[model samples]
Target: MAAVTETLPGAPTTGTGEGERRGRDRFHRGALRWVLLVVSAIVALLMIAPFVIMLLNTFKSPDDYSAHGPLSWPHEFYTHGLKVFWDRVDFPVKLWNSIWTSGLVAIFGVALSLLSAFAIGIGRVRGRLWIVGVFLLANMLPQEVLIYPLFRMMQDIGLNNSGWSIVLIFTVIQAAFGTYLLSSVLGTFPRALLEAASLDGANRWQILWRVVFPVVRPTLSVLLIFFFIWTWNEFFIPLVMLTTNDTQTVPIALASLQGDRMLDVPTLNAGTLVSLIPTLIFFLFFQRTLTRGITAGAVK
Candidate 1:
């Protein structure tokens, strides 16, 4: 009975071969993981290299930058570039204008988007798809194409050169994209939840606020952040609308420095870095919220 073992000609004789194959698979997997990790690290470094260079130049003196070029380290730590840019542009005023305009646009834009999406997606309105198509078309239209007409309209209403004009313009523009996105998202919403809310004696408004709003709040947060950041980076519209120095934003203020002559490179870099700080801080503060919102939407 003990001598009755049989083996096929090409088959493995024992569990050793099977175990070795598994070990080889694990080794290959580990090697692949390390390769991916190294590639990701390299990509990250490349992405941040420009920012690092900018930071270095921001603190360098004009003489230092001129002598050694952008890639070289600063000869000595210098603060004059920052002070020059801060004073030259009246940075605080520009910062405030940017904050005020972008903040208003984000809030109003999100509200407008929510209302439009609710009507199109949840209210079961006729021609809703066509309505969404229109919003999508609006989003695709270039800002340059609409700028002249918008400027004239603002001027006719005497809102030209006013911060409110910028606020109002961007709110509508941002809401167009938001509506397009939120409508699609709301289209896939659960009908059972809506029905249950209605059965619990909730009206349309109550159901929207209590059931739908809670579920879509994460998406709204994402839209809010996008709106804020987009409005902040807007250059062409703000440039056209805000003519005066007092009404100008950070971007305009920075642009105004580049007259016909060559300007101080380090000073310009300093201003650029300073302009990025507020938005960076805002993003970092809301990083967790943004991640959670994205994750929730993905799981749904």
Candidate 2:
């Protein structure tokens, strides 16, 4: 029996097999991470390259630009483009309008979306599913079809050609999609959390503020960033609704810089750069929230 014990079981001849499998798994994970990192870096550079070239072009004189490609570096940096931008454009007024309109749109849109999303997500009322479906349908519908009716409605309501009209239009248009996106996220939140909060005698408001808000914080950040960026870059809404210089958003004002026969590349690039700063600043400010929120939503 003692002599046969060594071969009695169908055990592996070597213990290295399990260790080898683990090593392979670790190698695969490491290789995948490095590949992703490299790909992300390359994509980021590609996205930013055009902007960098624009910046370099801004510093170059017209003579240099004409003689060389836009991608070529300037021999000497000059402030001529900056001067031209500041002198020609009414930067202060347009900048103010852009800031005010975009801020109002983002704030109000996010607020309305939160209420609507929470209703569909947590309430699960009799027609909750139907309501969500309606929102999704609206989201899928073309904006062009909605514009005419919206314009007539705004006219009847005495909101046409006003900043508030533009803000309201953008907020409402964005709310449908925002509500759907946020609700999808909120649905995955643990129901046990709400139940525990209720058992502790917390009302709906308390649950929202304490329990739900904490968990949904990341989703809110994403909504804020999305709405802000969309509203900031919005062009057509302002063009149609805000017909006057006083209420014109940045994009509309910038579009007016185009001439029938000639194009001013420096001024155009300068304005483009100016328009991007606020968005970059906004994203930087909330980057931590954005990253964490996206990760949280994705992980679950």
Candidate 3:
């Protein structure tokens, strides 16, 4: 009629088709996001369920627990179990011993690992791979296999049943793995920064502390946290070494309550909860540092 235009065959058309495709894509993406959220929530619930159950049972009386089960809530709020466990274990002393030993081990172990990794990685020592392999092998060795010899050695050194002995032993053990890990990270370190520092008349030690250390500090902080947690949770070694009540850590103190025949479930749970509080607090305080360090490492 009024000069109508005819489109050629296979000509592109823009309208509802593209809009519908985009809408479908957005809908699929939203559905997928909801699915992932549901999965993550389910996983989180599973992870937290045991802790919730433990908390519920911790305040339960032995009679109440026997009547109802571990999963059931307490009929009445009870403080007796917590007080009994706290006094029986000398909670303050055990907490102090753990803090002291774990703190020292973390500091000493991080220092040792930093020095060893620097020598092997930045120094580029001959046969560095073999040195790293030895560390790996040492780390792989079972604590049980070394426990007897370690015990004998500690006895000979007159450090048996001392918190210092546990500190020293765990420091060395933790450093071995730390060295192996830090070495790899340091090996791939940028040469440009090191060269720049060298050109600025920086010696090896100065360069290490001033330039390299700052960049790698994040990784070291991560190592410090790991060392602290590892030494904190050490049961077998501490159990064997710290035989005395005053010298023992939290785990040993809690474990001492377990008898050959009867077990006080509520008391044990209360102690367990108390023991976890310190570590949980430690982790919470350092949570930001841990996250920042990890993020820094990832960015680099």
Best by lDDT: 3
| Alpha-carbon TM-score of each model against the true structure | 0.94, 0.83, 0.96
Clash tally, candidates in order: 0, 0, 0
lDDT of 3 by residue, 104-177 (tens): 99999999999999999999999999999999999999999999999999999999999999998999999999
Superposed model 2: Cα runs more than 4 Å off: 1-41
lDDT of each: 0.92, 0.82, 0.93
By TM-score, the best candidate is: 3
lDDT-sorted candidate list, best first: 3, 1, 2
- Given candidate 2, what's the lDDT at residue 168? 89
Distance from true location, Cα of 44 in model 1, Å: 1.0
lDDT of 2 at 244: 78
lDDT (tens digit, per residue) of candidate 2 on 58-149: 77777777788688888778667767766566777788888888788888888888888887898776787888899899888876777788
254, model 3: CA deviation in Å? 1.5
Model 3, global lDDT: 0.93
